[model samples]
Target: MPVAIPLTTHDLNSGGFAAARARTTARMTATVMDLTREIPNIRAYALRTWHEATQRLAEDPEATTAIRAERDRF
Candidate 1:
């Protein structure tokens, strides 16, 4: 006689897998947003540095003329 197999042991619930995937997607989205949040701050700092350098160059005419002469060489 052949042995009988139990079907209850093969129960596969897909709902658990879907829930786990949704949680993972949400966490990854949050992480990506957090990582890019500093972009604006970095841009602001660069812009401030550029403005200060421009002001300093404007205050010194000799440096500005030298920069212009060098710029025309390219």
Candidate 2:
């Protein structure tokens, strides 16, 4: 679907509508594609952070104990 643009009758008659539609479509497509590319990197960062924390807590008795104690405070 083409992106919606506010156009007057004069603008439509002057072919400005086509130009505006094209620009809007291109901008929207670029934005969606950029987000598609970035989402995996975002997910990877979250997973990496989770794994690092998990490993640290597993390997450090004091950190594990502190985390458990903190959780118990709730």
Candidate 3:
């Protein structure tokens, strides 16, 4: 997917298209790297929360009824 950015004439005049493109690319690369670094942590958090939720449901006798009621509300 491509995104459009609105730049002023002055911005274009100062550094031109190449400079602007390089800057945008660098920022995007850094953002992707940051998210990549957090993959393991995010996965661990998701798994922990999922386990806790399932455990709670297992302990609650009325979990099925509650889930059905909640689903009907939507």
lDDT of 1 by residue, 1-74 (tens): 99987645234335666678789999999998987998899888777766666666667757966456444432
Query: After aligning candidate 2 to the native by TM-score, how far in Å is the CA of 14 from where it should be?
Result: 5.2
- Residue 20 in model 3: lDDT: 83
TM-score comparison, 1 vs 3, better candidate: 3
Best by lDDT: 2
lDDT of 1: 0.69
Global Cα lDDT for candidate 3: 0.74
Candidate 2 residue 57 Cα shift, in angstroms, is: 3.7
lDDT of 3 by residue, 1-74 (tens): 78988888877767567688889999999999999999999989777766666666567748886455444433
Worst 10-residue lDDT window for candidate 3 reads 65-74
Highest TM-score against the true fold, candidate: 3
- Sort the candidates on TM-score, descending order: 3, 2, 1
* Model 1 residue 18 CA deviation in Å: 16
Report residue 59 deviation for candidate 3 (angstroms). 0.2
